[model samples]
Target: MPLPTQEKAAGMTTRGGSTSKPEKRQSGCGGEVKDRRTVEDRLDELLSSMLTRDYLDRQIKQLKMDIHAENKEITERLEGRIYELETDNEDLRKTVGSLEKEIESLHAARDKTEIKLNDLEQHGRKDSLRIIGLEDKSENESVEECVEKIVRFVTDKLEVSLNKNDINIAHRLGNFTRTKPRNIIVKFTSRRKKHDIIRARKKLRGSGQVIFEDLTRNNQQILKDAFRLKCVKNTYSIDGKLFAVLTNGKKRRLFMDTPLSEEYLMNDGNFRRL
Candidate 1:
């Protein structure tokens, strides 16, 4: 037997009488190039992520600053409004105080005026007399006849020396009615004559006749109220001044403003018990 010689390539190998191709070897420079490219790509990605995070941080900072400024403006506006409301409330309190003082002043002025008016009214009726229980004989009586009748009645009933000349005016007090006789009002020329008639009125006590001092309307009301009190035994008025004689032997001088009560009567120092 004779064997022929065979030529083999660089990566070819012969094993057990068979020939096989070996794997090709990679170059060392190519592996280094691939590793450098991967490192560059990772660095680029890191840089991009850093840039995006920095942009987001700047936008958030700007938004926070804007929100802070807006909140500050709103707080300042609220503070200003609170200050304005406080100022207005203070002004309103002052106005209310001023109005209350003004009302008090008005009330004081009105009370003084009323006192003066009541005094003047009483002064006007000082020389007048009111005769009650007198018969109304005729509704058509003339002024002269009325005067003569009053003069005669005063002379006979009260036993006073009154003439028609002493009477300045004489007339019935109210509108004439058929149910009862109206009272006669007589204004005398002098207070002395009027007082004399009043003093003599005690004689006609049981004769179904009454004579009053022609008191002011307020005094008359006071007398009426005084008579209604359980503590009062008698009530009368002299020259527009009211007097109440209590059951406890005390004489109380009353005015239009006097409080009509048992406590006031018993405790008043002005009215001494007899």
Candidate 2:
């Protein structure tokens, strides 16, 4: 079964003695080495790409954390400032409330003091009298001269017994003016003597002479305001208590704080009707 040399070169014989073509064979191992180099190069490229992508992902995650931290810090700072402002505003409101209460207390205290002072002033003037339409010829008149004039006038014109000793002090109220004669203020040693003179004031009513009780400035203004009303026929004060005689023959007791209005003055219930 040995084949000829030409046929052996063209084909091969198997165990069954059948003719078959031979598999092709490479001349060297260069092709296999080249294919292995190509596979290593592709793996190197894929690993480098994966590493770069991982680095970028880490950088992005860190940047997001940084931004979140910065925003949290800013929000905390703003919230703290708002809380401080709210606390300050509440404190200011409390301070204003305290100030308003203090002001009201001060006003009440002042009103009480004014009332006490007015009462004291009226008490001091209980024995004093004001003589209007009295003649004052000289500005250099002495207090004793004024006292003598008051005594003579009370004795002669008023028909009342008055002595120089009964009058404690007498003086003109203001500077001498050529336009009119100033009134004289006389203080008596006793209220009895002042009352006696006042009781006799009506005798000189037609003689162009008048006498009035010494009143506080506030009471005086109240009397003046009462006189200005047409409904008030006559106004007078006895012991610093003011009285208004209305046109209907009724008398109304008035006070320093009474309203000087027609409606208030004309109220019938307030008057002692004739």
Candidate 3:
């Protein structure tokens, strides 16, 4: 007998095959289904990876924006603070300038007032003289009587005549002390009488008696310093100007407002140089 051919539904036959055709078709279909599922899974993974990348990109962009905003805010705050500080500094400068101007005005006013005060003081003391070496009287004797007796004695010693009415006022300068007698201050009615008394002052030079012009405290200190200088002699002040009689007999004018220094005292020509 001849080999039999097996026929299937689509008119296909297999000769001496162990598997049926239907089974082969089933296997091919199963393989196609598996390949399709693998392709779908790979496509899903690709889509997920792309979505994740997009999300990461968005997050990174947002973070960058936040950083930029914070930086901008900080910069604006710093700038504002700087501006405020600059404004404050400008106002402070203006205030300082105003204060400086005010201080200068006050200084000028003070200087003018001081000059006026000094002038008044000088005028008030113009007709005054100071007499030294007069002994303090006992409590029983009146001060006025003591002054009159001393004045009479001074006039007699100088061989000059002075009227009792010439002295407007006479008194000791301070309280009496046991150690030393206070100097007598005399105010004359007429400037002529004062000049006469001063002219006659040389008569009492070696007699331990002294007559001095009633100068201001400042001028008195200047006179004392001038007398203390080694090279100076016959130191005197006239009209607030200090004068010194040099050892060489030359008269030199000194700066009354400034203190006498060793440099000024040592060199006789220093005043001239000034």
Question: Which candidate should be chosen as best, given lDDT against the real structure?
Answer: 2
TM-score for each of the candidates: 0.69, 0.64, 0.65
Arranged by lDDT with the best first, the candidates are: 2, 1, 3
Off by over 4 Å in 1: 1-76, 270-274
Tell me how far candidate 1 lies from the true structure as C-alpha RMSD in angstroms. 12.7
Number of the top TM-score candidate = 1
Kindly report the root-mean-square deviation of model 2 from the true structure over all alpha carbons.
15.0
Supply candidate 2's per-residue lDDT for 261. Answer: 77
lDDT of 3 by residue, 1-274 (tens): 7554545545566656643433223354465234555779999998888789778899899999999999999999999999999999999999999999999999989877875776678678889888888777554456577668666866787767776688888877777776777788888889887787778888897877788888877667777888787777778865455677767676667653445754566665565642
Give the per-residue lDDT of model 2 (tens digit) for 130-246.
999888898898999899889989999988898998988889988898777789999999899998998999988676679999999988988899999989899998877789888
TM-score-based ranking: 1, 3, 2
Q: Candidate 1, residue 5: CA error in Å?
A: 60
Off by over 4 Å in 3: 1-61, 139-141, 222-235, 239-274
> Which clashing pairs does model 2 show?
none
Clashing pairs in 1: none
lDDT of each: 0.84, 0.86, 0.74
Model 3: clashing residue pairs?
Answer: none
